[model samples]
Target: MKRRRGSGLSETQLGYLMVMPALLLVILITIWPVMLSFHNSLFDYRLNDPTRSEKITSSNILMESYADNHYYLEGAIDNAASSTENEEAAAEVEQFAEQYNSYHEELMSFDGVEETFTTVEEMLAGFENINDNELEYVEVDNEFAEEYKAFLEDSAESLGTYVEEGNEDGLENLQSYVNSSANSILESNFVGFENYIDYFQDSRMWASMSNTMIFTVASVFFELVIGLMVALLINRSFKGRGLVRASVLIPWAIPTAVSAMMWSYLYDGQSGIIAHYFEQLGFISDTSQLLSTGGGAMFSIIFADVWKTTPYMALLLLAGLQTIPSDMYEAAQVDGANRWQQFLKVTLPLLKSAILVALLFRTLDAFRVFDLIYVLTGGGPANSTESISVYAYKVLFAQQNFGEGSTLSVIVFLTIALLSVLFIKLIGSDLFDSRTPRK
Candidate 1:
């Protein structure tokens, strides 16, 4: 006997099973990045900072710092012993110096630590930066690490006391050396929510966010209007219509960075062909004003974006228009409906799903605008065109401020999520709701 397919699973159940792989893939690509950024944002992680180069949750020793400080510290302690004139003071200084050396050697005696320490020392002497974590950092027993770190702190206090008793040139330097050594045992760097709190006070972050919203709203609105018109015009039969459709996609075909660069030269104030025409047409005071002023630069960017993406919007709308049955238009016309009435009554209602989908894509894409603006303007003429994505890029990669930059990245993700939710709830509800069977 042949076995029944899908066993007892209904169509809905099979549908869910069919889509599981896609859902898993989406989560991996989308949610994983946000979670990673959130993890980094929790700590004071920065590539520029040796102590905070990674997301850490426990106390650890930076062997590199320890080695460097100990080298200077050993000299400072000897200098202290030699500089003291009084016999009693010199004996006390010598005793402390011996204690410090003993502790330093004991720390090195930890399993495998001595070898790592030697390698680090040799590398340091060569002025090499220890990029390998195994060579630079070590996790030790908390109790042992704390005690050793405390001993270093106490050494610093003792040196300060020596300084107070007599103005010794070497005592101050020794105290600083002990303090630096103490810092080699780094405390846990898990600073929760501090990064999120910091963004509230970040003025430039807010400016970039505002710029993103403006860019999204303006670019999408115009793309919709212009794209709708192009789709309607192209939907009708005409000579060389296929050729026109192919040619219309050329602007969108260009890579975003290349298009932005192409437009940059075209928007040049004094010599740009586009800028010259706009100036000659009396649209501006001068050709140079296209990229020199805040408003003009923003306008220039928006104009370029519209030129590059209008074809995309048209393509999406055209697909939707084709799905529309011509019979409905004929019926509307038979009922004495004019061209305008037929569009308003039959066309728009049927095209709502397409409109919603197109808006969703374009809005998110425009909100995350970076390469276009980055190449064309580099967020300048004083950063007037900087989007949150571009700002995040500068912070994370340019400044190497990973902690603060991760927070910025999380903000962008959250903002995009909010926009997606809004679109789904307000515009896409009808489109998606129809999938459910009626009671």
Candidate 2:
């Protein structure tokens, strides 16, 4: 009988159709955000500073603040000129006002700016807020922005000297007006690859990366060893095996942040049982050293992480262990193979895929360690235990420096991507080797 062909789409097309939703979801969540971050990383974006608060590609005038400031600014400077007693200072202030008026006229003369300025003035007079971006910001030439910003800054500085010597009354207010107007003109903050360059040169970045590597390696290594031992113990038939497995998973089941906080108390210098025991056992010279010293803090976090995550690793391995048949051990025993020989010849070979999977998962997880370290040490004791993730969080949120923060985030993504590729290569090869039967 011929194959039924009700649908026109081929099998490959149908396969893609089935997976399209998942592919779209991944792009939406993962790819879209990374691309946005990359675009932001090119600029000097920050929320705290009004001048660089937005991602500007070219010079632009903040019409709302500028229009209001300019309305008062012109009158303020003219009033200062008339109110001053000193002829020299008065002449200088008048000259400054004339120069400023010329710059203002030049700025307004720019194509479309005059119309935008008129519209902005009308909105301000009627007390209507300029909420539309197109109406609120007018793009201008780079040269004019640079000149205008420089003139306002210099004028403010010169006016400050006059105010100090009592050369003019209201001179301070005039200076303030000049400064406010200057702030309304934002220059392009776009700086492609410069943030990356600076961060690569930064000592703190390298230090955090180094700490991340150390933590990943040490914690993963210990977890593998300890987890395998636990998996083997639990895999064997014994009374209360179910209870033992559940109890072992208690640490992994606890939320990372909560467990980290709990460990912080245990590692506390004063009135901590673990700290006291460690000190008495000659692990450290004093109880305070556990979280106080750089080496001690790194060691403390690594130890805590191994204790918390080993159970999870054990669970993964135990699943792999259960898949192996008892007949393999029986066959090995009939061949006069010792326990160690059976483990080496049969158990290890069969568990290769499981070990590779567990390693890859734990390695990636350990590399991105953040919350536990954050809650426990706060990346302090001189930032000796600070990972790249913690450093990125501080820059992104605490400092409100989005540009540099995004750059750090991109670095993290790239590193994680590279690590994933490496692991996948090893895993793919091992699985392929296993599937191909020996001759």
| C-alpha local distance difference test of each model | 0.88, 0.92
Compose the digit string of candidate 1's lDDT tens values, residues 77-128: 7897788776766776787788877877777778888898889999999999
The per-residue C-alpha lDDT of model 2 at residue 414 equals 91
Q: What TM-score does prediction 2 earn?
A: 0.94
Models 1 onward score TM values of 0.80, 0.94
RMSD to native for every prediction?
A: 5.4, 2.2
Off by over 4 Å in 1: 1-17, 64-68, 80-183, 435-439
Clashing pairs in 2: none
Off by over 4 Å in 2: 1-4, 83-92, 165-168, 426-428, 432-435
Residue 22, candidate 1: Cα error in Å is: 2.4
